[model samples]
Target: MSLTMAILMLVGMWLSVAAAMLWGVLRIVRRHSHHHRPPLVPAKPQPVRRPRRPAGVH
Candidate 1:
């Protein structure tokens, strides 16, 4: 095939691959953000207190 034909084919292949990737990514993003219901997150635990150390222990 001629150089021009080869270049055109290469460009078309690249564009097709890019479009497929874009479509896949968009579908995944939409599925992730659908928000049919609110997400459930575990409640935070309360911090425990530490005992004080003795003074003048140098």
Candidate 2:
């Protein structure tokens, strides 16, 4: 109920919130710092197959 106690409580709350925000920002920055590399050569293409019709239906 005293003014000093209320002020200290407010300051503590502010510091805790600020610390949490800073931690989250650092985590995000670290996560995105890595560069992902693609494969040097692309995969080989597959050949298409044609369906054969019945001997009498064609």
Candidate 3:
């Protein structure tokens, strides 16, 4: 109810909001930078071969 208490509460609320905004900005920047990275080349697939049966197997 006191003026000092009200001011403190307001400041705390402001700090919480500012911190949240900063965190969101940081996440956006990181995402943007990651998306801007060079595209990765796809790995070539090896040719498939049939498995050979053991010589002793009839």
Candidate 4:
């Protein structure tokens, strides 16, 4: 094979590998992603919890 053909084949192999990796990562990410994203909604506010005084002190 000519040097140019060898180089092109190597480049194509590398690009195909990168594309496959990207496809796998995208699949994983999409599988895990949810329609109901938790961070988008605001959490409920907690009521203030007052400390209780000791019966003897009071």
Candidate 5:
């Protein structure tokens, strides 16, 4: 193979390897992140009420 062809092939192989490693790392990160997340169903918020005024007091 010509020098240029050999150089291109070497670079391409390295790029593919890097891409594969990156994909695996990201996959693991996503999995762990989901494991720590709260449940999908959210709890209902409690209603707040003002205390009743004393009898005859404004």
Candidate 6:
């Protein structure tokens, strides 16, 4: 094969590999984000507690 053709083929292979790696990274990021999403509504509120007085100290 000619030198120019060989160079082109090498560059094409490198580009394809880079594109595949980028695609895999994006997929992983998307899946991770999907699993970590926060709830849309707030959680239930807890009731307040009143302080207790010491025994025989009133």
Candidates 2 and 4, the one with greater lDDT: 4
Show how many residue pairs clash in every candidate, following the order shown.
Answer: 0, 0, 0, 0, 0, 0
Residues 16-56, candidate 1: write the lDDT tens digits.
99999999999999998887778777699678898877897
The C-alpha TM-scores of every prediction are 0.60, 0.58, 0.61, 0.60, 0.62, 0.69
lDDT of 2 by residue, 1-58 (tens): 9999999999999999999999999999888876555657758877888998889995
Pick by lDDT: 3 or 4, better one? 3
Off by over 4 Å in 1: 36-58
C-alpha RMSD values across all candidates? 8.9, 6.4, 7.1, 5.0, 4.5, 2.9
On lDDT, the leading prediction is: 3
Best by TM-score: 6
Model 2 clash pairs are none
Worst 10 residues of 2 by lDDT: 33-42
lDDT of 5 by residue, 1-58 (tens): 9999999999999999999999999999988897786767758876888999999998
Worst 10 residues of 6 by lDDT: 37-46
Q: Between prediction 1 and prediction 2, which has the larger lDDT?
A: 1
After superposing candidate 6 on the true structure, give the runs of residues whose Cα lies further than 4 Å from its correct spot: 40-46, 49-58
Q: Model 3 reaches what TM-score against the true structure? A: 0.61
lDDT of each: 0.91, 0.89, 0.93, 0.91, 0.92, 0.92
- What's model 2's TM-score? 0.58
